[model samples]
Target: MTGANKQRVDVAIVGGGMAGASLALMLAHFCPHLSVALLEQRALPDADASVRLPSFDTRATAIAAGSLQLFSELGLWNQLRDYCAPIERIQVSDRGRPCGMSMRAAQQPRASFAGMLGAVVENAALGPVLHRALAQTQTQVLAPARVNRVRMVADGAQLDWSAGAGCPDTQLQAGLLVVADGADSPLCRGLGIVTERIEYRQRALVTTLGVQRDHRGTAYERFTDAGPMALLPLPRRDGSHRMALVWTCSEEDAAILRELPEHEFIARLQKRFGWRAGRIERAGRVSDYPLSLSLAREQWRRNLVLLGNCAHFLHPVAGQGFNLTLRDCYGLARALAGADLAQNSTVGLELLEAYGRDRRLDQQLTIGFSDRIPPLFASPGLFARGLRQAGLLALALTPPLRAGFVGQAAGFGL
Candidate 1:
């Protein structure tokens, strides 16, 4: 690439999905003087259009209370609230067993926002809101820009990218390069970052359900012999009561579930999930994703850092994957702010190392919580079942233990 096509920035973020967009917004808020560029391989949705990225699909994300606070600080809660359904309570239960626990936001005010434990928002609405906010910031947003090559240079890293097939490639020299290109990241592979993956051999079947009764701002976590299922509240549309469903099961079961007719699927789901959310009236299109625990060997190096699923892809049992990533983004932005990147190298090794150290505990706790919870609940053995019941009983009976679980689930103590 010619010098004319080359540019320099303090930080160049690859992948403009939720992770990258949120990080860009955070940097703009926390380190306003630093130059930042966000690059996405796909074309960004129009201002009035729907987002088509994989991250912003038919699925829904359960934003923890702490994450909501971060977005509110960014001045996004107003717009976000319009698309969100507040989660005032959470109901956890086993399919056949009576022992279970329920958590209410009122009981744990420290881990709540405006009387809400958290809120759920459809990814379609969330993407548009985030991108719309990014338009008001100083960060440069580049879509249809594919980075074909990356090389670690003395200053930091160099990226060669193109707008499309006919366009000439442009070179960008960044003091810090952040990879947020999702799991099994090709960019990470090219950079020699290896990911340790543990496949559960299960798939999460996701869909939206229309219920005959109101969800009443309750999120349900039901454990069954198949696996764990989560039914999170969603904003009602056109006088209909709706909820988002995430049902995890073995691969063989998933294949059978995916091919079943809507009515048959609802019947099976109702039978497996029971009457916790009331009668299921209608169902939307179903999608399934293979489950796994994927952790990148390195989250940060000299002048480079990894973000989002590219860094650590966890099981979605606890709805912690995106929230954890949000925390990571915020932490990195705060570190950059304290370092005053405008006056020094943006990709200083010492600064990056400090940031990683600060984030280690939160990452470990959240990853472990997501990794170990499903199997313990899914086990069929008598001892395992007894243990599950005992744990829930403790949480229900002990205020301190329940509060601790609520705090962690709400994304606080970071």
Candidate 2:
């Protein structure tokens, strides 16, 4: 509702969550001359010291070594270091089975190539840090703005959105449209992009827990009949070791566990996860998310590209969801940097093709691996169980195999 009803930019990003914010920042840092706009329905929360975000309230994310390097290159890692808990080692095992495999960062040939294997950061901490970094950039941010429609014009694409905070209902035109919306993306649906989906009939129970003993910078992945349970390390607070818990199980069981008493819930988790990280003394708020694989059959159009969960929703078995998206955004940034924005439509097509070609292999490898691992562990059949055990044994006995696993976990596929 203002004088300037339209805006023109070189790039327009929909959904200003972790992935969208990241792409905007990358473009700002690497391709400063390009005009970029980040459209978000939710307003960016203040990154001040006194603020606490509901999104960051009880969740934590594992950032692979490769992702950390990208943050470092953008000069934002220093802001995030204080909130990060480094993961120096990882242990994976089948519950009640003797077969298992472990990897230590120090055992790698180039131990310090990327330092620690990975790190964990609470969402409460990560969101603001990213928002602050975005604030430092020249990218125009349209928060509390809902996209009403998207039209592919002759030159590029045009977006119409209504903003809150007394802002105008504006229009945006850009050569490139980067859709980083989450899994249930309306934009993706409107664009007629189909998703190949597989419902796993499982729900992930996510919470933070206080451990009796130190986690020692180690992350644990315990596969059981219920599903895969991951205990990722978090920094100690008040001398208590904290670990992020992701336990997957049936929907009925998840509903029961979510309603159980904290002590009782921890007890059940302990019975399944064992005492690897010491006694599970207490738990924070528990939340559950349904598990499914949603992969967009087409990632790009003439002037559009999809990123993050909208592009591919993984099982989260190996904590590769966000990491893989980070790599995709990285590739897009590199591609855009070399393209000519003056020839909007032609360059947009060129960038989309080049970016898709460069990212296809990595996407296939990561998505295929994520899809396969969960089923192998979830199967209760004797042959499946035996295969799981044998695979673990092989991983333990073979150094090159172990190295490949480590590389994949660290965000570098074999």
Please give, for residues 101-201, the per-residue lDDT of candidate 2 as tens digits. Answer: 88887886442235688899988888789888898888889888899889887777889888865655688889788899899899999989999999999
Q: How far is candidate 1 from the true structure (C-alpha RMSD, Å)?
A: 2.1
Q: After aligning candidate 2 to the native by TM-score, how far in Å is the CA of 146 from where it should be? A: 1.0
What is the per-residue lDDT of model 1 for residues 321-388, given as tens digits with 9 covering 90 to 100?
Answer: 99999999999999998885653265778999999999999999999988998999889999999999
After superposition, which runs of candidate 1 have C-alpha atoms over 4 Å from their true positions?
Answer: 48-57
Which pairs in model 2 have colliding backbones? Answer: 1-169, 56-124
Worst 10 residues of 2 by lDDT: 48-57
Candidate 2: which stretches are off by over 4 Å? 1-3, 48-57, 109-114, 165-168, 343-346
TM-score of each: 0.97, 0.95
